[model samples]
Target: MHFNFPRTLGQEDAKKRLSAALASGRFPHALLVHGEPGLGQLALLLDLAQILSCEDTATKPCGTCFPCRAFDASALETLHHLIPIVKNDRNSGSDDDEEAGPESGQIDELNESISLWHRHPYGYHVSEKAMVRTSQARELLGRLRFAENEGRVRVVVLPWLESLNDNSATILLKTLEEPPANVYFLIASDHRSGLMQTLLSRCLHLGLSPLSASDFRVAAETLSQRAQKPFAARLLPFAEGSPGLYVELLENDGEELLEEALRFLSATSDWRVFADYAAETSPGAEGMERTTRLLLFLLRMVRAYQLLKATTPANAGTRIDTAEALEQAGWDDSLAAYLGAIDAVADLQAFAAFLESAHRAVREYSKPSIALVGLFLEYEGKANRSVPA
Candidate 1:
């Protein structure tokens, strides 16, 4: 099957610059691609790799070329994929368990993960513990120092560069400083704030903004076809322009969660409905997980509501003209009713703060149910107080 990357979804300017870089043979040795999670960083990296390795002398990445076919078949000799691994807590081995390298089992598992990612990059949610350890970095350095096997340009694709540990960072920094003749590094990360300044200074940095609504719609169509599932119109508000996050939600039964979240928010003005939902969802770990997802959806909605609130006219008084605000924000009718239920900016802020706190408390506290129940009760009291008689 031919796996395609959705280039039009976002990052138009970045793509143009990349194309220019390729056209000019004077591209940097290392590139740091930073963007929010689910913004197609890895897919862009793979696209660059394919472009660099394409054998066709004419149009770049003529997918029919030998190197392009090899890439599609997962047999590309010039490209290497690197991922991080953390300490295995389940091994029950001694601390001195020789630095012999990642176990064959771990390597096999990681390779399998990479293969799945190749098939569906956006659908493949990255592992939480995928951190690049020192040994892995050392091994990568050794491989990159060697001459290319194909007698062509070599590429090392590094995603989640922020996960690089101190030792690994040191080794990578050395590599970035020195000259590797024909090798290039393509690094992708979610958060650039955590990356080392020295490392940032060594490479060409390209920052990708979140996707626009129109672009997201186009992307949703492509993702829908790839996933073989019907697209839900409700996902736009929840996705907040992140296609990767949207795919993640889809994998996690996003349609059901969206329905539940919208229902919960709609019931905000009614105590009985809110109470019933709390009773059902504040019972156990599984219930808490669902509650957490609902709260995350709520947070996104509040953020959007806040955007709508900001555009309201000051002379419009305490009671917001919801229609006018929606018009000002260019929000579609889908979100009008749901957002209108939010009485005021103060209420939305308080609601959002509560959701964040509740999410944090559930993750941190031992008894999540108790914490969440108390949280909902408090929010209910505040929400009731906010309503006019």
Candidate 2:
């Protein structure tokens, strides 16, 4: 049940701003933290809660304090956690909490998920299965109407705000309009654009940008040691300044996948091999995200190749300032030969265009393997004709 504030990594500016506000007693009643996926938005929310409710006035979240421990353990009576859940089609809006015996499974399932998140705030696995429904939002409003327990400030943390269904969002907007006294709401999300515009205006919006490479490196190293896994240092550049993403890629065998990607691109002329690679790499429901990850890596490589080729031969040795920039716009030294083999500007552009199309298709819910294979077929048709065979 221990946590640290300064150690939140890559969020010093944000931490400082919030800490100052808290110390000055001028913090907002409702706040929204938004950023790219895996930026530790939930962790930040919990940290702020612990600090705000901590007994030690000077040190703020003295992790050993009762309130701090409660927040860390997620056992604080004053804290309410609301998350997304799939509607039970079989039991339409049944009060699962009041349901008797084994029928109370929904409440138990929700608690178990919350427990996992509390134990591993950063590395917790969020299921893509459920969503926030209006019933849950109404439940939250009902809870807020009651006075705070233990005489402490009441705090509600709602992570993944965009998961709220339309009805849920509408109910949430009403609560935001007239939030209960001594009760504060903190919502975090990666999809700000999807949020209701009226809801956005009510909360103090805080934007968390991607971390710096130095911070990302430190975070990756820490997570690697904690998870007892090897860190792929080379993938740091491609992680785009998000340590969470770097850890994800490292855990999912990103190094090997990228190697396979390079090979696949080189052998694009062979339809059978391309199809096989596409099929194997296309993740099913649980890991369907692999497709998007693959497409991102491919885009980075293609873009890097294009930029490097565009630069003067003498200036090609120069380095970009940031890891993000280097990954997106610079070529890997080891891949120089492969890059040279496909250095034809027109050909690279064509390939990049098709890759873009494939990326769009995946975003639009297309079958990834099929979309990628189709792209390969199209490219191969032209490639075969252009070659004297």
Candidate 3:
């Protein structure tokens, strides 16, 4: 497959390192790419994948090979995609690959399915709903047993590798440890605690940092012609480095939700509304989950703004760059009132225990409602009055 590296944002150092690996011919078979959730990690990976699978052996893909042409035309579908899905025989979907499958049931879903993936040599996105299932893992094992075609390498990219449970991981461990000669695993994740040590040792690590405001603007501004400039720029300051996330917010129709957030913060005079939204007792499960995730994004944005403020002061007032984005997003100004000096970020680890407990509560088995409340409670109680910076 052929791909053109996105001429956008990010640290040139990262690109240099990746390029150096290619030039030196020391590229790892499996790579662990980690960093902030919305910082163009996937886009970088897509470019890297193109480089690896390119038809031209002298350099990057020539984009003229048959496979490259297919990829360029967005007609290639050679990816063996996997992800989480909760299916019951009782439901509309059946497991027969010969029949129209779930991933092929809808236009969007069909494009992400394994059939199209195997035909295409380019980007293949593993959906959040496609959990690493035992059946899927076993299928992966079976597929890898055969030799690849055209002297090409095959890749298995998992964005949220942490989602795999113990059984699935163990099954994958066997494959990861002794992968085929040309098979590669590109696993990206936000939660490292869940991954095992052996698994970590098996892959090369590529740590990603958050994108600066400039790169953020490019990533977002390019989303649509209607919305340009600083508006798409909003996501850069707040996201965890994953454009997938910013895109998810866009795809999920987050504008209304963001509006509600702004309104709720402004109307905080009614503490009940704040409490209702905070506890998530008022909204249903879907609303609660989406809103909670959005709030979490806002909180991260606030942190990013704080970091920006400490480094780059603006105006005579306390007008931090990214902070203004947070305020615009509707974070309660009262929280900022309590926000200690920028020094507080240095001691962020001091509240690790509280955060860990809350995370465990949520990841393990706590009800969504309880988990949401417990998480924020931990945050409210643990943020110290003193700033360590």
Point to the candidate with the largest lDDT: 1
Question: Which 10 successive residues of model 2 have the least lDDT summed?
Answer: 94-103
Cα deviation in Å at residue 91, candidate 3? Answer: 10
Pitting candidate 1 against candidate 3, the one with the higher lDDT is: 1
Residue range 175-248, candidate 1, lDDT tens digits: 99994767889898887887789988998988888887788877877888788887765566667788888887
The residue-by-residue lDDT of candidate 2 on 1-389, one tens digit each, is: 23247435577788777867786787888899989877778778877777767888568789778877877677888888777765566755563322222226668877887786665566654566576656677777887886744455888888778877777778888988987777778888887986789989999988888786577788878878867887666666566667667777777767875775667666665689868876776777534566666667777667545455444444454432333333444424555544443453235556777778777766676586787788878876766666566
Candidate 1 error regions (>4 Å): 1-8, 90-98, 148-151, 266-285, 308-337, 343-346, 374-389
Give candidate 3 regions above 4 Å deviation.
1-4, 7-11, 57-59, 73-79, 89-129, 148-151, 226-236, 240-242, 251-258, 273-281, 312-389
Q: How does each model score on lDDT?
A: 0.74, 0.70, 0.55
* Candidate 1: 10-residue stretch with minimal lDDT: 1-10
Reference-based TM-score, model 2: 0.80
- Candidate number of the best TM-score: 1
- What is candidate 1's CA lDDT for residue 159? 73
Model 1 Cα shift for residue 143 (angstroms): 1.3
Between prediction 1 and prediction 3, the one with superior TM-score is: 1
